[model samples]
Target: EEDQGLRFLQAGTALGTHKGMIKIPVWDCKKNQQASCDLSHRKNMEPVPENDTGQPEWDEESDYRACTYCKDNASEYLKHYRIASWFELIEKTENLASHMIQRAAAFSMQYNGGNLQLMCYPRFTATVDDLMSDLDELEGNLGFVPDLIILDYADILLESGNDERERLDRIWKKMAGMAGKRKVLVVTASQGTRKSLMSKSIKTDQVAEDIRKLAHIDLGIGLNQFVKEDERDERKAMIMRLSVMVKRHGETPSEECFVLQNLGLGQPAMDTYSFLRELADSWALLILTLIFLGVIGWAYRPGSRALHDDAADVPFRNEDPEQSRPEQSRPEQSRNDHARQDGACK
Candidate 1:
């Protein structure tokens, strides 16, 4: 499946402890349906009278009836209906407001009281130049440049008549230029190529279209799922492999395995068993080669017959115990005393 850009955006925005503003430009909505609060249907509706219960009184004619009394009281019935609709609207508005407030409170509590302001552009679809113009306008209005700008999906911003590669390259260059000019981080996402779908791992080369896009990015991460054949018990947790495809400063061409805990949030997996299995698999050929070499060496090793005979007779060699022992002898002083005594006797 293709990458879900919106899910990633939501996950990324919620990650980390730093508090900052996140501006999201949604280009999918139509031009007329811009703001969340714009209620076009409310234009034809009239305000309802205060203290008016929605239910009709016993003496009042039902609005649905075709009697003369109903026709005469049509205005009153219409007023009543409007009041009922107004009441329903108020009830719905209250429920929505309450939900939003509770959600905000919960999010605030979860984030340790730090606030993250999320600003969304209404029905925004623009080219590179148009985006730059909007950025300039925003900076002018806010009196300062934003710290971060996230383009939801870069592939959708291609020009009308240009080649795909050329357009993408131009878009990336403009994005890089914006980052440099504003001194702000510009984050964007793109999908992998069709070939990457069947692959076990994703790399920078698997990125859609021209690989030159990697040159514009400081860091690029490729995410892929772990494929296994066991389908018996289907409750196994989902595991994903994340590869560091491109890194301008730090470690690159590295991999990390993780289990998805919630949404796009993943926790590092303890892969000791998997690591050992992979290690053994990777060394199998080398180990076999070494074993073959050892066998060849044992069969054809250059060795004299004399060397083998000497090694074989080492355990059987014996010597006389008496010949190996040293004999006891008298001291020189004792000998000298004896000689002196003999001389005296003479």
Candidate 2:
């Protein structure tokens, strides 16, 4: 019985046994034009054509905006862009994964010992069916099914124009179905509604196009920040709140606060200074309360009774001198009347 229990424990403790690779298929949509442009600049190549009219010839196959590089050095630029796009995608995914791993470590989850692999698909444009087919191919090549899939900027899969909400809902539902069918975790992101941009904190309702998207997600987290207008110095750290809008396995509708070390990237770190400041404020308020009570006690002390009485009577100290003199003279006149009565009786 002891040996059997030891074996069972060992099996359970085995690391990376069921762990699988994380595959991210990045869709290099037109939304990432700036990143592509930056890549071209780094390669000392002009991404945009600058003719006399300063416009590149439209290439409908490549979705228009085909620059001179695409026209002249098509093969070379294609290879370069593909490589650069993959690098950009991998870098971002790794950064996010690292951040997540750090957070998980705090909860005593040893993700570092897990079998994690990153696979990038650059310039991938395909329908849901095509994506599944490609995933099948990837499984065949890798000899095992992926446990996690990330579709970067998943909204780009939607068709442009006309009933965007309906289209987004359909796409998200299909993605959710894929997750269920594959029995794998599918992670994607959607843009927030315009109103969400102005909001200090975002909720499931703030998801762009359709709030119905929340129904499909097992877990959803919203990142929010509110920068005060007076915080002119960029060096000053800002606070960001991460709210768990949806959760299936654990607690939902929870929030945690962190200070942003880099506002541009919105990287969060513990705000020790803010914690200390709050502690100081609490101590200051307690000290002030004690001082106020002490002052009150001293003012009403037994030794201060005469002083308090005099202070209380100070309000009537400015009475008219003529009015007071009249009262004193009436008392003397009453005594004199009594004396005169006695003399008359005698």
lDDT of 2 by residue, 10-81 (tens): 333322112233222211212133235544424333242223443222222333222223212333343333
- Across 1-346, the per-residue lDDT of candidate 1 in tens digits comes to 1134333333434332222332211111111121121333222222212123332211122222111221123333222111010101011122222343464456557643322333343332567777777778766765546677778766677455558888788778778888888788888887888777665567778889888788888878776653334311111223345666789996664445332332322123322112333444556788999999986666445652223443333322244334544654667668878998999999
Q: How accurate is candidate 1 locally (lDDT)?
A: 0.48
Predicted structure 2: clash tally? 0
lDDT of 2: 0.51
TM-score of 2: 0.40
In order of appearance, the predictions have TM-scores of 0.43, 0.40
Question: How large is the C-alpha RMSD of every model relative to the true structure?
Answer: 27.2, 24.0
